[model samples]
Target: MTVALWCILIAIFLPYLCTGVAKVSGGYRLKDNHDPRGFLDSLEGLGKRANAAQLNSFEVTPAFAAAVIVAHLAGNAELVTINVLSVLFITSRLLYIIFYLADLATLRSLMWFVGMGLIVSFFVVSV
Candidate 1:
């Protein structure tokens, strides 16, 4: 698939990765309860951050996917623009996860902003 399409695939699965970390941390505890709030409340530090990242990933995915589709339909087919934003969004999200797990709030917030900017920039390129 094209880079843009691959990005859509990545967007689809990123949340799962974050959740996996959370679950792996919780182990049998989460496996038993499996209640969203309970499982989330049980986490601390890096696990909590993983859960937050999972939620945030869910929140951001739709717009990012939509933007990819829009840019695809816009017929510019400017793979360079699409690919750059794709990489930026993915990289920022990875860094966001790392920073969040490390409890570096400031850097995490910056990465969040950068991810948002990259998301917004996709719309810009679509136009």
Candidate 2:
């Protein structure tokens, strides 16, 4: 449960971190409606990606939480690996968001792979 709570915390803050980065990069104001096409388009894309990242976090977090819970119930020590991997997944996801916003497609893909690998690895180890 504690691990799950930490994962949730990371999930909640990851998108906000991306949003803050976008603002710093002059992407767009959170509430601004007056921007040029280029800025608006970029900002919209950033917002969408941020939202997508949040949704992805939600998608994986439950599987992570369930894995941990099952491990606990089964008295398995493998949950420790899953917990660590969950943290790694969250960190890699944040990196993915930054790379995505910077338009580093290859790096973003690599980071995404790392995150996905962690999630899949967790499931494999949990079972």
Best by lDDT: 1
All candidates: CA RMSD (Å)? 1.9, 4.6
Off by over 4 Å in 1: 29-37
Q: Which window of ten consecutive residues has the lowest lDDT sum in model 1?
A: 28-37
Alpha-carbon local distance difference test for all models: 0.83, 0.63
> Tens digit of lDDT per residue, candidate 1, span 32-127?
665766777688877788899999989988888888888878877488889888878888888988888788999999999998888788777767
What lDDT score is found at residue 111 in candidate 2? Answer: 89
Candidate 1 has a TM-score of: 0.88
Candidate 2: residue pairs that collide: none
